[model samples]
Target: MDPQTVYEKLGGSSDSEFPTLHSEVARTEGETPYLRHPGVILIAKPDVDIEGLRPFLEGYGEELNFDAYLDDPTPLPPGSLLLKTAGQTCYASFGPKRTYNENAQRYFDNLSSSGHGSVFEHAVFSFFVYGVSRAITHEVVRHRAGTAFSQLSQRFVSGKVLRFVERPEYQDVPTLHKRFEQRIDFLAREYDEVAEELVELQLQGDPRLVAEARTDMRKRVQQSARSVLPNEAETTMVLSANVRAWRHMIEMRTDQHAEREIRDLYFRIFLCLRLLEPMLFGDYDIESFADGTYGATTDWRKI
Candidate 1:
């Protein structure tokens, strides 16, 4: 087929790259949506914790004189300095010999391009993400290295407020969208019914339990009923990752072949990092799509 005909057939632009297609594909019920969606917040990042560093550095010497001179007129941010210092410590590469003005930028640029990603481990970031489906977190928790996660517990929280993620595919289909909403509401109502039945059973066993341990019994009942929760249930999580881990995640998850929800998520993360530490993440060439999505290639050939 002609390139234009092929592009039209694929349902995307001529410039866009498409995921590999196959026949008889194994499909999951809760695969991520394939559209631009937003639900990431950069809650915290490394700041100049000068006071915190003072005590540790005192062990080296009482009067340690060190200075940095860079060709870039703009002074480096504290986060950049922190990354450089952490990397330099590994080689005992302090002083003008190793971190000279002439070689300073070159050193960091080379470090990133040469795949010495360990240096980035020193810088960490935290985010608060909500309004995402459980399916998204399932994929996120798989990246266990140099990261930590704390997510909302379905067992403890009451499933009364049943808000769920709406996938992009159904945006234009009002009937389907309404059906999805109704299904969620129905499930939540059923969950409440089951919890009430459990509570009544408990009360029958111990007449005074409802009056004396109302909260405990309710929580127990909800925990049991939580098994029925659907994958579309919205959840929240606080995710923390070091710079190295973030880079790895972005490289792997923001590709054309990655699940759309995760790709959308890490793309937001990439933007956040770029805003906070431009020197470190600015080299990445992130592309903005007409559909309001963002993505990038792992090839750091520019650096």
Candidate 2:
């Protein structure tokens, strides 16, 4: 009966694709260390009824205080949905819709509260995530159906630089914040210098010594590097969710307890979708979990 559990069940089960990190001719310093967005094209549309959008706000954004969210349901509209989580607050909204009429894309630019009239499954999305933990990835990869994920490997790419998602609680303790930042800076510089030096030192050293030194260097690198990087550091990944998945992600990530960065990302993505169809997404309601997964009941009518 739990919403998220219901949604996960829809996916049948789940799958995590282990991709090989091909050793290609590596690029230079800029953008190389960061997660590069592997783009995937997506397209779709859903029919919406603006007049029906009013009665639709009933259970939508169940967590927001109506006094602050809309005050009156007569002309109610959802510009954005905010989630309160461990990392940061997230926001979601719908934009106007565009329809194909007589071989032309008719643009409807309306930003308001309108029910997305039950046509989300028509759209879909794909994404790639790098340098992330199995933990966070597990949470995200759970969309089950209408969602696909390709992740970096520990055996291949090596999590020697295991990254983490930091919580906002650390910010409250000024000392922890400074220490974390300082560690991040120091390790990053150390990794760059060490990796570079090891490569250079090995080029001239005896082959056997080079191998030994490489192992030692990686250890030393991981030492300081690991300390600087904690759970909440920035992670790079390309995420795509169709209209349905988008709504699902927004409802979950925008809850009052999701991580900050992920919640922020979902909010932005939701806003983008809303821009595409104000009537459809605007009209739909949402239910959220404290842990951040949107409640998905088996009863589609309820959703």
Candidate 3:
């Protein structure tokens, strides 16, 4: 096919042909609509095998006892226990004189104070983060070290039921809120119209196009049509990171000076991590700001 024919088949020849393909995706009333807040669910964490470590303890020295932790009435959470064990393994600190389960808080505090963070990497956490904006994720993915992410793909998935995230600032102001809603509704309709046009253009009785699979054709159409989607478009992602990386990100992102939307997201993540492994995250002091957002500070900033 000629270049012009191919270009027209793909969608349009130039950006001027599609002026409405700007801004964010939107949703119809019966469909899932705008989300006002982000959400996070801790879906996974480290699970240590205390009994499995017994053989390693014996090989190190008979004086090294893993049974002490196994026999204790109050056992630590798997993530905390794994961190403590990894830290103690460095010095063979497993005997009675070693910091016991009761002193786990102090042990972790020492780890943070001393900037010994390698052991913290042994405990990994996974979260299902949803209803967040693409803008926030653009920042989240920047913390690439010791972190893994599986985010929603706009290409393969249609945005017919797309949802936008309303900024906290706009949500409280009546005029801004109304205008934002109207904009989203208009964009949603625009997305549907553009997507339909693209679909029709691609499938318009061309033998080569007709030969393409239905799913492949849809992917091509939606991928181009999704350019109109804005940073405020709601996206879901699975974020997995080690304790060290999480702490570093939380400390950086939850500062009072950080962007308000992301600070709110990370503060919730910090709370979840603290609940999951208090000994590791207990040093953070969470503060609520006048803007109805939260920030976190810790004496041990990086570690």
Candidate 4:
């Protein structure tokens, strides 16, 4: 998720928004704020276990055999899990609780039968996402059902030159390739020079003046600097999505052609959840849209 997404997730301002609670959701109906879905959701702290997550991160780096199921419908690796959001408001206008609540109820009941349902709602995750454009943040902020986010802000910060996204097919043709690279390179170098000069001066000045110069430089440089950033330069966001919102994120972001970066991020998040909370996760599925949606088009909005 990007900063814009964060801005959007926090939706309508309120004291209630920050101290998010399940009970408050009942009052949110049409009154829900327009905040963006947080890029990363952090759960209520005391319940978390750092040790449980280590294995999930580690497993991502391991190699897997894809040849065995090359021609068939194969599921993701076992350690991978679901981040279901069948009722998220942003991705889809879940008709109402009457429809989605039943799914949630059943899913939890199934888990309860195994004696693990109570902890299901307590489930949480920190999703680290990358490679999304500011443009997409518009849609991501809508899954406000249950989650928290931390994203990169452009308002108070400036980027390190702009990096635009380039597709593989376009790069294969020299005509389009050279122009794109040159444009990106020129802006990158220009931004570095200006920001560096400003930083060096601030380092040598009095504290107050240093602050002033830093501010001035950041503003001035960003004025022209951001012009070079490409829509696809990678952005990293962290989200604290609960079991419910996870399902929603998967429904939307995990679909074909969700930005490759977000798709990759959602996949990682799904896999992580699958490992620690299997009983709660087993009911949801990610394989539904894993194949070709994104590869088929340039329209990332579909994700």
Candidate 5:
């Protein structure tokens, strides 16, 4: 199946929790509005080998002089198997076999609820996100901890078919939307024009570049012209972050005050997290509006 469909299935069949915006918000100064569409996709998540971790968990418990509790009847949280492995070692009470039982759930619940979120850092997820604006990524990259990123290079790819993102608020405003398209087209055209000039200069100055394909030379030139690209230009990236980093991102980006385009992106991510690790994410309150919008508060209720 396609990645998009897979992500949708992971989120179950829920309706959009995206929040609706007032028309005026789209027209706010310094904001270029466009239609909002879901863009984030789950590319990869942690694959925990439970048995593989048992020995270490057991050993850690012995070293710490604590016995793990293993008395609950409830099943283990599927999505958090990796987290369970790491968290089980935190208290170091139960032996390896008992560390994965119901008692582990209580331990994780306490750790998460108590704000010792560092344990969650052991579980990581990687995502391939597309159709997001450069503006949105600027905010996302600011998250410096427990995360790694690999993004499409405008210098290499901008010379191909150029794409752009439209803000949701501007979808209803035909004039503004048209203007947005026109501006994007203009920049793309200018990029090509500038690239051609730079390529010619390179060929004249360096004989070695001529031995390489014209495509390579063009790519090098594109690096120079990409400076003209706008923040609204569409881009793709692979973002990998541990569970704790993801929680921080979801909380910060889903706030009411966040930019609408980015809020929508993070909400989709939040849904995927809920599907993957309910016990970890289910306690967070995600609010939805009549207009198909959603967001969450900074605080999480204990599960």
Candidate 6:
């Protein structure tokens, strides 16, 4: 889906007086320029099919029974259920002595404490991450394992309405903020002018080209013109990662020493995950620092 649609899906407001790259307007100072903060929407998650798992549990052995868990009125969250099931399958631990509904949290707690993170790979979550700077996405894509990313391509997408992310450090200082805004406004104008020139240049070469060919030519020109865009340019991506990968990213990105922008981004991500599956992300202890940014720590570091 397009970035605008994803941003709106993330609960970002569509109405803004200033121009925005997407539907969300994180911050708007005046009528001319606006700034945006990174946004994340959990679009997809794991869903456990108890009936599908029923056959496997039945075939495992007669000594173990998962009837109670299967029939429990309240079930574990899908990710938690999938992880617990995977963990139990490894040891055939399905029995009345340890039940899912009553003991899922404890089971996951042991998994975290004991560093059994492989089962976490069984549960995956997908998010549409937007309103972030390209710099932040550069760092995000570094997490290559057990993760998938589909990011917006400056090559194919026009930069006609470029939006920028103002650094947290610059926001409080009036001079710095004004300078940053001026730079962004200048860059936006330059990008538009350059793109128009390139488009004209292409048309001059072959004005008779068909509609499809014109589209291709426009993409080519945009690709070249986008080089003028700064690292602070807002971008969008769809990131899908397993629970283990998410934990690893959260632990690393939300550290005190991490870059403030990305740290804030991941902390927001952590909040989303915590709300979705507390059993999965409850170990994190989040705190706000003096700079008004947040950091998170977990005793279960690598798990």
Ranked by lDDT, the better of candidates 2 and 6 is 6
lDDT tens digits by residue: candidate 3, 139-217: 9999988999999988878875588899989987999988888888877778889888876777687443343577877
Best by lDDT: 3
TM-score, cand. 5: 0.74
Count clashing residue pairs in model 6: 0
From the highest TM-score down, the ranking of the candidates is 3, 6, 5, 1, 4, 2
Enumerate clash totals for all models, in the order shown.
0, 29, 1, 34, 17, 0
Q: What is the lDDT of residue 92 in candidate 6?
A: 66
Let me know the TM-score candidate 2 reaches against the reference structure: 0.42
Question: lDDT for each of the candidates?
Answer: 0.64, 0.39, 0.76, 0.43, 0.65, 0.75
Q: Which wins on TM-score, candidate 5 or candidate 6? A: 6
lDDT of 4 at 188: 56
Q: Give the per-residue Cα lDDT of candidate 6 at 166.
A: 83
Q: Show the lowest summed lDDT stretch of 10 residues, model 1.
A: 18-27
What TM-score do all the candidates reach, one by one?
Answer: 0.74, 0.42, 0.85, 0.47, 0.74, 0.85
- Model 3: per-residue Cα lDDT at residue 148: 99
Model 3 TM-score on a 0 to 1 scale: 0.85
Cα lDDT tens digits, model 1, 201-224, are 876875533445666766677778
Model 2's number of clashes is 29
Model 1 misplaced stretches (Cα beyond 4 Å)? 1-36, 49-74, 97-105, 206-216, 288-292, 301-303
Off by over 4 Å in 5: 1-38, 53-79, 95-106, 206-216, 289-292, 301-303
lDDT of 5: 0.65
Residue 52 miss distance in model 4 (angstroms): 20
lDDT of 5 at 87: 64
